[model samples]
Target: MSILADVGAFALKLVLILALVGAIVTLVARGARSRGDDQPAPLEIRALHEQLRERAERIRLETASPAQRKALRKTLKRKRKDEDKAPGGQKERPRAFVLDFEGDLRASAVSALREEISALLLVAGSGDEIVLRLESPGGMVHGYGLAASQLARIGKRGIRLTVTVDKVAASGGYMMACVADRIVAAPFAVIGSIGVVMQMPNFHRLLKRKEIDFELLTAGEHKRTLTLFGENSDAARSKALEELEDTHTLFKDFIRDHRPQLDVDTVANGEHWFGTRAAELKLVDELMTSDDYLMQRMETHDLFGVRLRQPRPLMQRLAERVSMAVQRVREAALLRA
Candidate 1:
C-alpha cells in the first residue's frame, strides 16, 4: 500500500479506538450518576436505609427476656445460638431531619416546603432538631403566606426548627424564616424586606391618544379595580388604595405575630435590611450559614436530607431517559468532531 493510504488507515483506526474509549467512559460515568427509578438516592438516604435494615435485624435477634429466649430455644432449636446475639449490634444511630426550601419564594416552594415539613413531623419526634436551609428571593402575598404556615407547622409540632439562610431571604422569604425557633444568616445574606407593595401602571393617556376606549362593567360598586386604560374613576382609585392598605396591614400583622419583639412601625416601611443590620433590628436572630451548621451537626448525627418521593409517570421517566441518551450521543459526536 502507498504510504498515504497506510497513514490514512492508521488514522482511521486510531480515531475508532479513541471513540470507543470515550463512549465507554461516558457510558460508565452516566450509569454511575444515573437518577435511579427512585431519585438517585443521596448518601443520606442510603445511610438511612442501611440503618433501618440493621435495626430490623437487631430486633429479630434480640430476645425479650430469659423466658422468651428459652421459649424460642424450645420452639426452634437451630435458632438458639443466633437468638443470644444482637444482629448487626451497632450503637443507636443519631437522627437528623432536613427541611429544604429551594426555589423562588412562590407557591411551588411553599408546597414543597409544606410537604417536607409534614414528612419531618412523621420521622422526627420530640427533642429532634430540623435544619431548614432556605434560599428564596421572596414572592407574592398568598404564596408566601402558605410558605410561612409550612414553617409554622414545625413550631406547632414542638419541633426545634433552626433556619439557615445562606442567600437572600427577603420579603416573604423572611416571613418563613421568622417562624423558626432561631434564625441564622450568612454575613452578607439579604435577610429582611419587612413590608408589602402593590404595583399598578395605567396606560389611559396612551390609549386616548390612539383614539381607543375601554369600557369595564361590574355589578358591585368596587368590584373592578383601577385599570390600565380608558381613565380610572376616583372611586376606583380609592378602592385600589384600600386594597393595597388592607394587604399591607395583613403583612404587618403577619410580621408582628411571628416576631413580637420587632417594632412593626420601623420594619413595615417597605425597606430591606442586610444580615448584620437585620440582626440588630431583630429581623434575624444571628448570622450563620447553612454549611457551617451542617458541618457542626455532622459530628453528632448523620444529616439526612428528607424529600417526598415525587412519583413520575412511567411515560415521563421513559422520555427523560430517551432525552438523556440523545444528549450523550450529541456530546459524543461533538467530542469526535
Candidate 2:
C-alpha cells in the first residue's frame, strides 16, 4: 500500500508538469500564428531627446534642492512657450536619426539596417543627419560590401552620415565605416585592417596516410584554385595569392577614393591602430565615442533611434531558450564538480 501511494504521488506531479508545458507551448504557438508570414516586422522608433531629458530630470530630482528644481522647471516651461510661439518653419529643428549595427562574421545586421535606412531616407532631407553607431570586427567580403553600399545611399541623397565605433572596426568593418561622411571612434578603439586574407588547411597528406581518396573536377582551368581535401599545385597556390592581392588593391582604392587625404600605400598593411593613432594616420576623422557625439548633437538636433524588430518563429524561440537553459545547467554542473 505504501509503494502504491508513492507511485501515485509521482504520477500526479508528472501530469501537472506536462499540463503546464502544454499550456505554455499553446500560448507561444498562438503568438507565432498572430504574427504570421504575411505581416511585416514593426519599426521601433525612440526619441533620444525625450529619453535624455527624462534621465537628466531624474538625476536632478535626486541631486538638486527644491529651489533649484523649481527654477529649472520654470526655465523649461518658458523655453517651451517661446518655441511654441515661434514661426512655423523657423521652429523646425534639424533632426538626427540614429541606427545601430552590431555585426558578426556574416554582417547579418544588414537585414535590419537596409530597412532602417530606407525608412529614414523617405523622410530625411539635406538638413537632417544620420548617425550610425557601427560595431563590427569584420566578416565576409560580400556581406560587408553590401552594408557599405547601403551607407553610400545616404551620401548619394545629400544627407550627412556619421559612423561611430566604440570598440573594434577592423577589416571589412572598416570598409563600411569609411563610407560615412565622418567617422568617430573612442580613444582606445581598434580601427583599420585594409587588406584581405584567406587561409585553409589541406588534408591531402592525412588522407594519403589513411588510404583514402578525394577528387575534385572542374571545367575551367582556374575554377578551383585551392582545395582542402586535395593536393595543391604550385600554380594553384600562386593563383590564390594573386586573387588575394587583387582584393587588397581594390580595398585600398576604395579607401583612397573616399578619404583622398590619406596616403593609402602607407596604411593598407593589414595592421590596426587605436583611435588616437588612427586619427593621426587619417584612418578616422575624430576621437570621440558615439555617446558623446550624440549628446552634443542633441543640443541642436532632435535625435531619434530607429530599429526594425522582426519576430521569430515559435519553434526558433523555444529552441534558443532550451539551448540557453542547457548551457546554464552545464555551467552549474561544472561549478559543483
Candidate 3:
C-alpha cells in the first residue's frame, strides 16, 4: 500500500511539470501572430502629452495662480480631444504621431513597426502627420526591402510621412528613407550608399587542405552562383555581378519613382555622404536633427509617441535573463584577460 502511494505521488508531480511546459509553449505561440490573422498583434501605445503638460505647468507656475494651475491641469487632461481652443475660440493645431526605428542587419524592428502602422492607418487623418525617427547602417537586401515597404504604407494612406536620420541611413537603410515624403538628416549624419553590395569568405581551399568536401546541389540555373565552398568559375562570378547590377537598378528606380528630382546616376555609385552633401545631391530634403524637428513642431502641433511590442512570455523572459548573465560572464572574462 505504501509503494502504491509513492507511485501516485510521482505521477502527480509529472502531471504538474507537463502543465507548466504547456503553458510556456502557449505563451510563446501567442506572440507569433500571422499577418493574415484578424487578431491584431499586441501593441503598446504611449502619449507624451502628460510629460509635456508637466513641463508646461512648470513654465507657467511662476506667474500662474492656484486657480490658473487647476484650470491648466483640467485642460491638459483632455489630451486626446481634437484640439484646444485658443483665445478666439479657434482650434489650436493639428496632431503629430512619432515612432522610432533603430534597425539591425535583419531589420527585426519591422515586426513592431508593422503593427504600429496598422494602428495608425485606422485613424490617421489628412492633416495628421507621422514622423519616423530612423537610424540604421543598413543590412540584408530582402530584410530592408520589407522594412521599406512597411514605411511605404504611410504614404499610401495619404498621411504625410517624415523620416529623420540623426546618425546613419545607408544602403538598405536608405532604401527605406527614400520612401518618405520628406527626409531630414543631421549635419554630420551618414546617408546614401545607393547601390548593392555583398561579400563572403571562401573556405574551399581550406577544406581541400584538410581533405574535407562540401557538397551543394541545386535544380535551377544560377541557383548557387559564387558559393563559399567549391571551385568558382568566371561565369558564376559574372552572373553574381550582373545580379548586383540589376538590384542596383531596381534601387535607383524606386528612389526616382518617389523623388523624381534626384540625380540617380550621380548618387548610385555605392558611396555614402554627409547630411549637407546628401542635401546637395537631393538624397535628402532637409538638414536637421530629429530633436530639433520635434521641438519646432511642438509650437503648433501636439506631439505623441507610439510604441508597440509583444508582451514577453515567462520562458522567453527567462531566456533574456540568461542572455544578460552570459554577457556579464563574457565581460568579466574580458576584464581578466
Candidate 4:
C-alpha cells in the first residue's frame, strides 16, 4: 500500500510537469503566429495638459501650505466657472497634437508616425496644429523621404505642421524637418545636412588576394552599377556619381519648394550647423527647444501627445510572466543551496 501511494504521487507530479511544459509550448507557438498578423496597433493619446497639471499639483502639495493650496483650488474653480459662462459656453480651444520621432538607420519610427498622423487627420482641423518633436541624425534616402511625405500630408490637409528639434536633424532628418510649416530648434541643436551620400566597401581586391573568385550578373546596364564583391569599372563609378547628383538635386528642389527663402546652394553642401547658424541661414525658423515651444502652446492650446503602441499578445504576456516566475524560483533555489 505504501509503494502504491508513492508511485501514484510520482505519476501525479510527472503529469503536472508535462501539462506546464505543454502549456508553455502552446503559448510560444501562438505568440509567434500573432507576430505575423498585419493589423496595426491602436493609437494612444495622452493629454499633456492634465499631465502637466498633475505634476504641478504634486509639487505644490509637497511644498505649498494648506491655505495656498486652497486658494489655488478656488482660483481653478472660479476659472472653470468663468469658462463655462463664456459666450459659447466653454468654447473649444485649439488643439496641438504632439508626436515624437526618434529615428534609426531605417527610420522604423515612421510606421508609428504614419499611424499617429492618420488618426490625427481624422479629427484635426485647420485651427488645430500638429507639433512633431523630431530627433534624428539622418539615414537612408527612401526611408526619410517617406517620413517627409508623411509630414507633408498634414499641410496638404491645410493643418498647421511644426517641427521642433532639440538635438539634431541632419541629412534625411532635415529632409523631414523641411516639410514642416515651421521648424524650431534649440540654440545648440545640430541642423542641416542637405546632401546625399552612398558608400560601400568592395571585397573585389580582398577576394583576389585570397585567391577567391566572385561573379555578379545583371540584366540591365545600370542594374549593378556598384557591387561589394565585383570589380568596379570607371563607368560604374561615374554612373553611381550621376545617381547621387540626381538624388541631391531632388532633395534641394524639395527643400526649396517648402522653404523658398533658403539658399539651397549655400546650405546643401553636406555641411551641418548649430541652431543659431541654421536660423541665420534660413534652415530653421526659430531657436527654441520642443519643451519650451510646447509649454507656450499649452497655455492657449490643448496639447496631446499621440503615439501608437503595439500591445503584446496574450500568449506573449503569459510567457513573460512564466519566465519571471521561473527566474524567481531559480533565485530561491540558489539562496537555499
Q: How far is candidate 4 from the true structure (C-alpha RMSD, Å)?
A: 6.7
Model 1 residue runs over 4 Å out of place are 1-94, 309-337
Model 4, global lDDT = 0.89
Clashing residue pairs in candidate 4 are none
Model 2 residue 325 CA deviation in Å: 3.7
TM-score of each: 0.65, 0.86, 0.76, 0.82
Q: lDDT of each structure?
A: 0.73, 0.89, 0.84, 0.89
Model 3, range 1-337, lDDT digits (tens) per residue? 6555655565566556656765776676666544325765556565665567677667886568887988766665665353443357666467789999998999988889888888899988888999999999898888899999998989988999999999999998899999999999999999998888889889889999999999889999888899889878899999999999999898999889988999898988989999999999899999999988988888777888988865655567656655675566556545544
Instruction: For candidate 1, write residues 1-337 as lDDT tens digits.
Output: 4655655565567557656766676676567557463453222243543464456555654745766866654555455456556477765446667667775735475655666676567878676788788888788878888888878888888878889998888888888888888888988888777666667789989888888877888898777778766578888778888888888888888878878988879887878778898889888887777877766766677667776555554446655655675566556555555
Candidate 3 Cα outliers beyond 4 Å, as residue runs: 1-41, 59-92, 312-337
Model 2 lDDT tens row, 1-337: 6655655565566556655875799797887777875777899999999899878877876687987988877877887789779987775889999999999999999999999999999999999999999899998999999999999999999999999999989999999999999999999999998889998999999999999999899999999999999999999999999999998988899888888888889999999999999999999999999999999999899999999997766667766765675566556545544
Off by over 4 Å in 2: 1-35, 67-89, 312-316, 327-337
Q: Whole-model lDDT, candidate 1? A: 0.73
Give lDDT: candidate 2, residue 81: 89
lDDT computed for candidate 2: 0.89
What's the C-alpha lDDT at position 191 in model 4? 97
Model 4, range 1-337, lDDT digits (tens) per residue?
A: 6655655565566557756976877888778778867765767889998799778877876687887888877777787688678896556999999999999999988988998998899999989999999999999999999999999999999999999999999999999999999999999999998888899999999999999999888898989899999999999999999999999999999999999989999999999999999999999999998999999999999999898986655667666766776666556545544
Better of 3 and 4 by TM-score: 4
